[model samples]
Target: MTKKSETGSTKSETKSKSEIRNWAPINEIANDVRAGKITALSNVEKSIGLIEKHSEFDAIISVLDEPAKKRAKQIDARVNNGEKAGRLAGVPFIAKDNFLVFGGETTAASNILKGFEAPYQATVINKLEAEGAICIAKANLDAFAHGSSTENSDFFVTKNPIDKTRVPGGSSGGSAAATALSLAPFSLGTDTGGSIRQPASFCNVVGFKPTYGLVSRSGVVAMASSLDVIGPITKSTEDAALIMDVIAGKDKLDMTMIDRDILAYTKFNNNLTGVKIGVEKEYMDEKVDKEVKQIISVAIEKLKNAGALVAEVSLPSSKLGLPAYYIISLAELSSNLSRYDGQRFGYSYPDAKNLDESYMLSRDIGFGDEAKRRIMIGTYVLSSGYYDAYYKKAQIVRTKIINESREAFSKFDFLIGPTTPTAAFKIGEKSQDPLQMYLSDLLTVSANLDGGPAISIPAGFAGSLPVGLHIMAPQGEDRKLLGIANGFEELSK
Candidate 1:
């Protein structure tokens, strides 16, 4: 059994442990808190200690020290009063900096928005708080969610927790690293184009990107309006499902949100007797790492052994998904990022001659190189002469990808592949070459392009580095996707 110190004081007062390997799951922590085996304050202190010890990863951009402690005390009081706490009560979790939480700045890991405090809580934050989950800190990400790697973050690049020299994928890099290192039980991350799933794959954790419009994006910093979805990265699929239950619902604030019956995603814990799993031949080709492909092959065999029919399915349009996604995402980003023009909020450059100069100087200094590249690409694509050739053509291609995915799903319940072409690469491995970095997301971007639900679960390791099995289902099939992942998790275990 896991043990805790008895002194019941701040993290500074406790004796430190060196292993850095002992930590309990969220459900186990909650059970201990409720049964008085440990106090919530002690748990929060330990989490704070872990964060401080692993500061090199730069996973936490800001820690809500006082507010988190106060919230933990309130939860303990409620338990003492004999009140029923919600499912995730007294659990500690982190929210990516893109989320607007009350106690800390939602910088989105950009200098342009540094120290900008939110007046209102994000809907997902509010929902988790209602369930007694404490928002301990804000995790780092690619600034404005613009890049495939967290190197685009203005503050710092998040290192992969498994191997300190490698990167944890992004824009959800910090969230995945935090959970991987057990800094928090789970963390909320936003996925636009393979952000959540890819990072989770690198960190060997469970990352769930729900169906588009299933989770409210009311207060999330918008990257690509059509592709952004808030999801959870956790140690286990069941925990991911638990976090989803709290945050999934219709919100009047986000008009794109739909009112659908939210099912208990945990109920997906069953054998995969009748499930049909499809392996995309395009994703299994020679372009992917041999070991990563082997891991996925093993997962497919496990599913087949569990009585699920497995077959290779063709998604010819998937090859065009990355280019199409970049075009669409940049077009949307170009428009969304226009709001940061020094007037209303965010940072403004000094010594500007006029409005135009201020806008130009501020943005030039504020955005990183990769961000500027995308902005320029977006401007060029949306420009009058090239609009039809680039932007419009990408949209037409996107439509084709979506239609092809729908058709494939009509025959197979879920599509499976390697979540990423390889495991976590070195931190500076592909930073200088933007196109090489973009190709890192080749296998994971199709689901985002099609606006479907997808997940990445740890399948096995390629040597010491972990690989993830990618599973995707049609839009509005969040429950089914989780169920299928749960089935795979059980079989793999």
Candidate 2:
């Protein structure tokens, strides 16, 4: 039940089950909080209450009950005092566990750092919190964001909110699942090689991966540093855009941050006149499931009906993206993971006799199977004899992919494709075959390799599950891409 003040006036009425289930978008809640129609405290209580109700999904790693309540009360006091509570005032959200957040551990779903507390907060988190958005919990992810299926998480597999038996799309699976189940209006996830968009597709929510360097990565856990970009998974493309305004910009800590004039993305233009969209030729291949293909085809037709000029385009280098992405990503991952040697950071082995043995035993006991496999593959590729053959070759291939993507963007305003080849698969379905699991990201990784912006929106459903329509735009065209995605998202409805 919603609470009232001692003055005998109701603070706010409780939201209906349908409204809560559908999740009132960010703007709606923020407006209510600002207008005093709803107290920030009430919003926090409701969010925490709903998360408890849906606890069976195992989507969250830890809850920030005390801090969230304290923040909400602070926001409520500001509102009562006739002060602005910031743009996102009183909107409760979730951060992927990989982000360094205070008041809780930043485990990244790995046992090696299970008890490690973050000394500070991620830039994105501080930005969101500054705008009065409350982070009530941390969502789970693959250990070190290494695997595509969240099953590699050292803690526990995050269940897809749609189908408990099916796997949520990973490395950002928990964030996507939390958004899908309406645990929050929006959630943060890091996209490196389709981590955000894939899970967004599986969960039938909107997931956006901005152009690399658009969002600052300061204070976030390193995972393939060059490939990692932070983005949002929200109930609507508009919500994602609203969040972009707060978090997207140059940061002093991350030298790679870009300075560009970004438009107000929430104000979408429905007119698609003169807009040319390319349908990636390879995305229509028979490898995609029949139902997923049909759904994507229908979504493309919606854009066409809205006066978008749709045509087929070929990017021959697209097929090489997945393998090249894995090589480059694993290589970077090996270097990033090398810091956890049990000398002064992460989990330490108590029974080791010597320093070398300590390094060996600590990593073996701390990292999960998927993480170990990637490390081994990475170490081998970057080895002295093989470095020139594999690591250097992968970089050359990456440049080719980026150049091809840029050339395509010269002719087309955006590229259209299916986010995933299929819907959420049953848990343990592809766990034994790592290769099969890797194929799940085949359609969504190119954007990451090319450092472009991409978004996944609910298109249509196959059977009881939903499919996503993936859209891509050239690097630094994030605002334009979000506008196109929002327009297409509206067309689907």
Candidate 3:
């Protein structure tokens, strides 16, 4: 286990001054607050200050300073009264713009829903609030969560905290950037393919994508329903586990949720002596950058050092994951996005001659170029004659991908890989090339295709950029996967 330190120690005494109190884990922050060392209101103010200081990243789309302060006061009052607040009492967190929260607009970083107000909070938001966690801000994301980089966001692109010129991987770029810069203790992000993990890797934070049905998706804006998942991005694996414990469970509003015994995920951080980790041969191929491969090799060595057996494995079908994911996701996107047709909600063109014209005009004007491209591609793939050839065939390919992953896991406790080919690319590097943007997710799409749980943890640094190593498990094996990650985390440190 990683060594624990006393709260509020001076930077000079800590092993690394830069790692002192800035990105302290949620549990440590909670302990200090409960012990009267730090006030909830003070923490909120600190976060506000950090947000202001790092405005260049454009990570926060909107800050709910007033409401967050009021909530912090309430938490302090409850603590003073000696009443139990909950697991995350007084902890501040941000949610990706796609999650509906009360204090500000949930824009999804898209012009179409730029000023849209949500009538209710997402189930995850409500659950977190019940645990006394404050929503301090809404983080930016790719417009409507449609792109691999936040550059597609109609509002603004979030820059990497480590290097301002490099992109903070997306569509969860803002969430990852916010967590990395200590703008918030933790943030919630959505993943369809590699949205959460890739950005988390790029920003050098812990990002988790729970099993497809493990978390409720009731109030999150629909992207691709089959592959979409809501998860946490935080500074440490344990913090991610803590957030998951609070937000995960079966929800009646989401029928896809399955009934399972809830466990404190952090309790699984015991030794992973008997775990079997599969190192995919395809992931270590020549296509991967040398530095990224070195990072993954180091992480695998850490796992092996922690007493886990490491073995070479193959998922030949994984090569088709990106294409299959795009074909299937676009088909779903075309259907889910049809709801913003100028009549029900979102921006509407005022000068249209008729309803159809209004719908077409508004969409054409509101959506960014990347969004339009995906929609058009989706429309083409789902058209009558091509649906069977592209969409249907992709679904079949998806089944093969899922089967291969499942069979591979039968002999292994988890699968490991380089979260991305390298590190964060420069903003606009791949935005113009649709194929290049799609390939960025080559390493992450298979987990979504198989509907399993996966996490990206900072392995180490490559040059100045960060590299993330992914650990994945079969669906519903979240606790085991988290346990193995926690163990590896200890070894790496």
Q: Which candidate number would show the highest lDDT if scored against the true structure?
A: 2
- Per-prediction TM-score: 0.94, 0.95, 0.95
Task: Spell out the clash pairs found in candidate 2.
Answer: none
| Candidate 3 lDDT trough over 10 residues, lowest sum | 1-10
Which candidate, 1 or 2, has the higher TM-score? 2
Regions more than 4 Å wrong, model 1: 1-23
The number of residue pairs in model 2 that clash at the backbone is 0
Tell me how candidate 3 scores on lDDT.
0.87
Model 1 Cα lDDT, one tens digit per residue, 429-465: 9998989999988988888888788999988777667
Q: 173-267 in candidate 2: lDDT tens per residue?
A: 99998888788889999999999999998887889999899889998888898899999998888899999888998888889887755566565
Enumerate residue pairs that collide in model 3. none
Q: Of 1 and 3, which scores higher on TM-score?
A: 3
Candidate 1 residue pairs that clash: none
List, in order, the clash count of every candidate structure: 0, 0, 0
How much lDDT does each candidate structure score?
0.85, 0.87, 0.87
